[model samples]
Target: MLMQIEALLEHIEFLLIAGIVLVLAILALEHKDLVYAVFFFGIMASFVAGFFLLLEAPFVAGMQIAVYTGGISVLIIFGVLLLPIFHDTTRERFETIRKKRLGIVLSIFVIILSGSLVFLFTWPTEIPAVNVDLAQSLEGLAQWLWGNHGIYVQFIAIIILTSLIGSLAILKLEKAEHLNPESGVYGLATWDDDTSEKAKAGNKSEDTVPVIMAQDAEEEGT
Candidate 1:
């Protein structure tokens, strides 16, 4: 009897976890506000970590929290906050995004893709009794990252970061150049306010002539 009861309880617990994950995934997708969506995404990541914990995978759970919940969530939030598209009021910005048929189609496709992936993945029915020593694995990984292979990995990461920064800088420069009144991209000169003003001033100076009044002439004669 106790075995049957324990099995029932376990099934109920799995159902609850799966339901929570499903609900969060739907909310994250249906959410219109990017900020709210980010929070929902973080919550979803946390729930996934919970699943990893239930599987007796502490390292996976920790990494899910550290990498997805913390790092990726922060990056998403920052993208929505720091990017030009997010600088406006949420209504106008999202309304514009909503109007784009391509965006809508892409979003639907992604939702379908994610749902399909979830269905395709095989969820383990039971947790393993024995687990790998994550501490040793992590220690080995640390040594690999910071020892013999450290130089190449470090340089690769630096190059990637530099490339990202350079791309962002180029994008910003392009936008600024489009907005600039005095010059085009790459310091190319264009007809602008300064040029117009200078031309007008030159034309005025060339056209102007000194006039001598009759009264000035009489005073000079006297």
Candidate 2:
């Protein structure tokens, strides 16, 4: 009787966690606001970590929390915050809106498909227990990452470095474009006040040069 009660409680806990994770996933994908989407994603990652813990994989759960919830989510949030300053435009906004709608549709489709699969499939009644030693697991993971799987780490580092270089290049180009008013993107030049004033002065100077040359010619003829 006690074992049945414990099993029932575990099932309930799993149900709650699964439900919350699904909800969070939908919110993360379908939300209009990028920051809110990232926030939901982080929460979903945390819930996934909890689900891993419930499966008796504590080290995997901790790694999920540390890698996804703590690192990648924070990085995405920062990117969402900072990217708009450089890329804020009507076209970009429209694209974002379109993508949000697409995301909503995809999320709905995925949920329906997943539910259908779950309904159609027969899940095993008995799940095998996992006995994990944290220290041994960590050591093995570290060895895998740094030894035979070292190429994967190198690839990831290269990708990150390439992205960083690309970002720096974009910033440099944007700065150069901002300095040159003619190169401003989509008629939106930063430092508009100063650039406009300089442009007006240049126009005035060019106009006066023609007038001054004509006056000099007329005086010489007279």
Candidate 3:
């Protein structure tokens, strides 16, 4: 009876995880707004991590949730916020004809490749015995990460940290440019009283008509 209950629990967990993954995938693919798309992407990454956890890969799952869903998603949101023009309006940029054609071709290729791979792979009819020792798998993953792959782990950490710093720096530069026109960070000239006067002078030159004041006097003499 206990074994049957445990099996049922495992089956339910699997179904729930699969459902979450499907929902996340749908949201990620269908969302139009970049902000909403990033949000759904984060959710999708979290669901993927959950699936990995259910498969007894705790370390990889934790890293997925932490690095991808948390760190990267936050970075993306911050970058979006840093853009001065982001708040002005919400409109989809129309894709060029060439871009549309390329996208369609790439999508068709992916569909065909995936279909062929699925059709080629044979499913085993025999059900393999499930490993009930979840703790053992988690321990093994921890050992592998800290022992054999510690250097690799450190390298990845450093990469993520550097990327975060670079993104922040770019955001700072954009914000500075937005706030100060005189800074000339993006080839933007300062708009002051002198600049306004220069513009008026230029306009006056175009609008002004030169007059020959003596031309009428000479015609009268003739």
Candidate 3, residue 112: the lDDT equals: 99
**Which regions of candidate 1 fall more than 4 Å away from where they truly are?**
1-9, 83-222
Instruction: Tell me the lDDT of candidate 3.
Output: 0.70
Model 1 local distance difference test score: 0.71
Q: Which structure among the candidates has the greatest lDDT?
A: 2
Best by TM-score: 3
lDDT at 191, model 1: 42
Q: What value does the lDDT take at residue 188 in candidate 1?
A: 29
Among all windows of ten consecutive residues in candidate 2, which has the lowest summed lDDT?
86-95
Question: How many clashes does each candidate structure show, in the order listed?
Answer: 0, 0, 0
Give the alpha-carbon lDDT of every model. 0.71, 0.76, 0.70
Candidate 1 per-residue C-alpha lDDT over 30-127 given as tens digits, one digit per residue, 9 for 90 to 100: 77786787888899898888777666567778989999988999888888888665332243223233357778799899989999998999977665
RMSD of each: 17.4, 14.0, 13.8
Residue-level lDDT of model 3, residues 1-222, one tens digit each, is: 998997798789889978987887777666666678668778878878877766667777888989998898888877767777544234433234567678879999999999998889997754486664668777877778897789988998999799889989998987877787442323333445564555446543222322222443454455
RMSD score of candidate 1 (Å): 17.4
